[model samples]
Target: MATPDLRELYLSLVCLITLVLILVGGVQVVRHGLKLLLPDPPPPVFAPPPEPADSTAMLKPPRSYEQAWQQTERLRLQRQAIRGLLVNLVLLVLAGLIYRAHWRRLQIMRRT
Candidate 1:
């Protein structure tokens, strides 16, 4: 049996590394995508209402404040999910491309 050349070994190592990275990135993308698609509802706030102000200006209802909080929380979660998904997607694509390129190079080396 012939020993593998340095270039072949290097290409094989890179392909293996990229494959692992691709798998990890793909899993992360799926997880984030699911979170973005089906986010869990935020738990209800059971805290007491804010103290009444002496000002004549009308104060917002407690329920309205709770609703606003929920909305803000949801938006924040959505942004996080989107960011995670995008980051993972980029990782997956880059890893896949790298793996492909290296695998092709390795194959060509073997052929030659």
Candidate 2:
């Protein structure tokens, strides 16, 4: 049996670390994407009228349809950003794996 080379072991370890980071980052990106897609609780439709004695009190206006549409658009942008991030991460992970495979093949050829 051939003894393990320290350099080869170190390379393998580094590759494993990169793999874990890629997985973790992908998961976080997906989670954030889901959070963005989820709908927020609707605002209360009606509020109690202010007391007549409290002249300084102002009634809160209900959210308009335009305002709601804008909020939805913002959420859509957030989801799109998350999608881009995840896609980039997947590409990076694929590249890293290809590089590691090539490195391993070279190492094996050198040993023989």
Can you give the TM-score per candidate against the true fold?
A: 0.83, 0.50
Q: Which ten residues in a row have the lowest lDDT in candidate 1?
A: 52-61
**TM-score of model 2 vs. true structure:** 0.50
Distance from true position, residue 12, model 2, in Å? 1.2
State candidate 1's TM-score.
Answer: 0.83
Write the residue-wise lDDT of candidate 2 on 1-112 in tens digits: 6765776676666667767666676676676666566644444355467667665245644457547766777777676767766775675677578657856864785578
lDDT of each: 0.88, 0.65
Evaluated against the true structure, the overall lDDT of model 1 is 0.88
Q: After superposition on all CA atoms, what RMSD does each candidate show versus the true structure?
A: 3.9, 4.9
Best lDDT among the predictions, by candidate number = 1
* lDDT, residue 26, model 2: 67
Worst 10 residues of 2 by lDDT: 38-47
